[model samples]
Target: MPHLEEHVSLRPYNTFGLAVQARYFARFTSAEVLRQLLALPEV
Candidate 1:
């Protein structure tokens, strides 16, 4: 599984720098990894 980042800020990813936050975030390199993340209950 990919490393999960908690309380991630959305500013860097957004077109406009908005100060929003995410409870959990992960970066997947493959469809399998994405599926694994989707399978988690927290997701």
Candidate 2:
């Protein structure tokens, strides 16, 4: 499974540096991996 993370902060990713949270966060290397992650219930 992809390295799934919940409630991940978006501050570093944000250009404005605002404290935002993502309900779910994951990085996929390929389309198949992305499909797998998207298949998860939480996604």
Candidate 3:
């Protein structure tokens, strides 16, 4: 496996305006599942 470095950025524009490690991937079984996942705060 390849090394996964943090997804860093100088500007933090999230709700808190703070730096947070960006998520790389998300998996879903179907369209319904994807929609459910999309409703999540971290999606």
What TM-score goes with each of the models? Answer: 0.82, 0.85, 0.39
**Candidate 3 per-residue C-alpha lDDT over 1-43 given as tens digits, one digit per residue, 9 for 90 to 100:** 2222345542455777766665544545678766766676644
Query: Model 2, 6: alpha-carbon shift in Å?
Result: 0.5
| Candidate lDDT values, in order | 0.89, 0.89, 0.53
| Model 2: lowest-lDDT 10 consecutive positions | 34-43
Q: Candidate 1's error at 35, in angstroms?
A: 0.5
The lowest-lDDT stretch of 10 consecutive residues in candidate 3 is 1-10
lDDT of 1 by residue, 1-43 (tens): 6677889998999999999999999999999999988898887
Which residue window of length 10 is worst by lDDT in model 1? 1-10
* Model 3 Cα shift for residue 9 (angstroms): 18
Per-structure clash totals for the candidates:
0, 0, 0
Can you give the lDDT of residue 24 in candidate 2?
Answer: 90
